[model samples]
Target chain A: MTAAGFPIVRAPAASATDVRIDPALVRRWLVTFLREEMIVRRGMRTAVVGVSGGVDSALVAFLCAEALGPANVYGVRMPYRTSAEESFRHAGLVQEITKIHDVVVDITAAVDGYLRYEPDASPTRRGNVMARQRMIVLFDLSAKYGGLPVGTGNKSERLLGYFTWHADDSPPINPLGDLFKTQVWQLARHVGVPREIVEKPATADLIRGQTDEEDLGITYERADRILSLMLRGYGQAAIAACGFRRRDVRLVWDRVNATHWKRHLPTTAVVSPTAINEFYLRPVDY
Target chain B: MRGAKSRPQPSSLLGLVPRRTSLDATGPSVELAVVQCAPRKGDVAANLRRIEEAFAALRHDRSPFPDVVIFPEASLSGYFVEGATVEVARRAETVVDELARSARRACGRKVGPFDVVVGFYEEQDGQYYNSALYASLGRRPVLRHVHRKLFLPTYGIFDEERFVSRGTSIEAFDVPYGRAAILICEDACHSLAVTIAALRGAQVLYVPSASPGRGMEDVEPANVRLWRDVLRVAAAEHGIFVVYAGLVGFEGGKGMSGASRVIGPFGDLRAEAPFEGATILRVRIDLGDVRVARAALPALGDLEANLGQLSSMLARTSGQSVPAVGARAARRR
Candidate 1:
């Protein structure tokens, strides 16, 4: 129905255009979020972010530098054996602009050490090993440098289950979890991120010529719109009616539905009235 | 302590004639402050020290000290405490005495009476209730009133009803400034509580809230936007001053937006704190505005008279037993 509810026809509540955000307000808000979460709650003065030369990590590095001083933010670049060389150059661009502390730890030997035992491992299995190895290095660096690791995942990647289940989402705090990938681009540009890195295709560097949109079977623009609409209680038919392809909408919806387990802590069976996670709930930092 | 200068006789505050006895049930133009501070989760001693720092900050900033200061709900213990409610909960009387002692010690030789309205988890008997206390500190310490939160929001990110027992009543108790009532957080979201306060001749409604900011689809946090609408409507329709004390800082990953504000009887914003971290919002509120607004709009007056006409509808929808203190407050009116 329209504003006045008549069952005959309905106007789309929101379309892809509604995905725009106020970048200045978001920048200020997330800056305070990072500062408060790190300094006040965790009692840390530094943030360690694995800068992939991607927009999400670049934006988080900029925010971390602004929240704590530039000297306090550590931008670590962990490239795999077959990783693109452009990833480091782009991360260098972010570091030059942010003037953050830089550290580079290559995971070729560590990931290869684990993969040597499994010679027939596929690219997906090898990618998970590389990703998990990167997490181990960043966490150990956090302990050594006294800086907490900050997450760089965005809403689209999270909802689509694009990132590794445990390795990528293991950070203690995430400031960009609520922002979509397209919105992340909007924020990265507003925060004075270099145009070269912001315009680059997002990649996990799992294999040569591998891009996120290619693996996901949809563009971030289309997927973000569908996810945004679906989040507001829109169904597959309703979203497709808004000029979205039924196949694309179904693909996005299926990914979101299939990944519900990835977004939550491990589920436990309830034997009695109270279960570990069922009835026992506590606030974070508890 | 500065007592009401125009008191005609020495009288007990309770069981007074239920009418607007003095100054339209209005009183002197009072200086008020809302202490919007963040309490650490389940740490009352640390929060008490935080409250003391807020008091010191207030004394350093303002002059002609405030007559009243309000704090956000669960200011002693943070919100979202599920199984820890019993551990964090405290007796209202004991907390009031401790608040009085702290206030006196902070004031140091500067003696003046001021009322403190603070929210906490209350452990009375063996039950736990989300409660707020209004007590005097400084010259003459007195426990004036206690209001248990009537509405326990149990949806979305909230699971309040699961951990704590719900309060049964909405009552407007007598305050020195005028007859005022306490509505803790979600309690003010309901119009019935505000209407009950207006019916009981309360000119001020003290609302202490600990709301996590969400819905980033707007320029401001959506929770803050909706709260402004709720409070403005409550103040304008009821012809009462609405003092809102909001919690600041993050609990878990949830950001508590702090824009502690005061709305006048005419629905005009008097003062507001920033949305950043903790800050004290102080403003002067005239109780006579309550008399002026009620006289001009007169909606509460109509509500009182026409409520009997809607009794059948109410009797049908009144869910449980006697609305304990709200019914008593309405009966007095």
Candidate 2:
């Protein structure tokens, strides 16, 4: 039986006659593909979403639990030594409330141990190392349990140079890439993310007592409003009207503009006679 | 006074009040034929006439009439602009006017509530855009809602960026039967626009393309295996209907393999047209497909998480660290 409550209709084969296409029908087809291909055939599809205990990860964990069942969704809480105790607590509470698989991996030991080889590392360099370590931990869990890793970064984070390279960026899927931080909160509430996770101070919790706004020099509410306006094709003045500092808004814009390469597949030349650009395929095996 | 119970409730200029035709708990089990036409090179008038004739033949004939007709990429102007000027690239108004007239006429003839979607080369302020027009009785012919091929295929056989500007907006509007979204040929390959439309609550996706290729007999053959894999995966994941209306027949010596097809909400091939010439395909879509898919997998509910993972991958690629293979391996254990 199909997931849509209809018996699965397997066509014998594609005939030259099977070529008439309707756009409306295609949408239904893709949804069905996701259900059968990813959920059923894949089997025991557990997923891990790295939660900073902020709205984005919190919301993602909640939704993954809903999609894969609480038992199949795993929540990984990776906190650095500088991370606030509350961030860890909130992640734990979110896991308990949502009933998702939860594990706490403290990376301070591994990071600090690695940094001993190089004592003169700058804060930014150290931060990047810490972020990558956290990703290493999450993927380790994914391998152990057999699932895909989910990400929590939003358009705001992607646009603001707010994430670490090769760290939180790499995931099999990202549910909130198009959404702004504000929109993430809306979805968080809709998905019943814990109130603590929703209302907590937005922080990467990278440095001791650090917060995202303090590091970026702008609050998410302000940054998200600016980003929303910009994405809708508005100009600088229109974005500034949203109460964000003009410099901060421009910074976010430049970050998104500069890092656009990270958002796409590797740029390959369409050199082959029949080589279509941007349709390159890579095989994956588990 | 003669009994007026049978008289059509005095027609109104403002809008025709829909009569209470028996509303079925399940929507009409009616099949819809979606046809894509590749207008002769720069011949808008011929294209309009061809569309009119197809509409007439389908509507008047005892054979089944399609609920909607779709046209290929720039089918209005044949997707070719000779002189790069506004006068040369200007969209012929005849296509829009004729399409609206056709829809109104079809409704009047009770041709089963028809709608027409056409693509054209639109020129405005010295800039040319690859645009589409959706004409129906319930709504006016809307031409500005264009899906300019976002990822312009500047290489191989495609040079879209050189001729057209990219479209920024993603729109899905309400149709009588369902909310519909449009993505032109190259747009379909990218997940961004499709995901945007899905997020915006569109239930039907229309892909109008002038896809070029040969091998009408072997194109997307079931025996090939990979195309079927693609079909099964794309349809089932999105939980929405997808209709591909591709241009067929020979144009400028290049064979257009019209492998137009409709995939059901559950990712099943509902109907398919031939790979050559103009062909018509019809299939009935039940809205229940989406509901059922959601209920069975319960996966769509976690759409945010799924998208978040992709976004994270995007973030990971930003920095210099090799995408932690260690991370991928960890998720498996």
**Best model per DockQ:** 1
Candidate 2: regions farther than 4 A off: A1-37, A40-44, A241-245, A261-286, B1-13, B17-333
- DockQ for all models, in order? 0.52, 0.01
Segments in model 1 whose C-alpha atoms lie over 4 Å from true places = A1-17, A268-275, B1-26, B317-333
Candidate 1 C-alpha error for residue B273, in Å: 1.0
Per-residue C-alpha lDDT of model 2 across residues A104-180, encoded as one tens digit per residue? 88888999999999889988888889989988988888898888787777877887768886787887556666556
What's the C-alpha lDDT at position B321 in model 2? 38
Per-residue error at B190 for model 1, in Å?
Answer: 1.6
- lDDT, candidate 1, B29-111, per-residue tens: 87888888878889988888777776766676636678898999999988877888988899998898778777766776674
Q: What TM-scores do the predictions have?
A: 0.90, 0.46
* Per-candidate local distance difference test: 0.83, 0.63
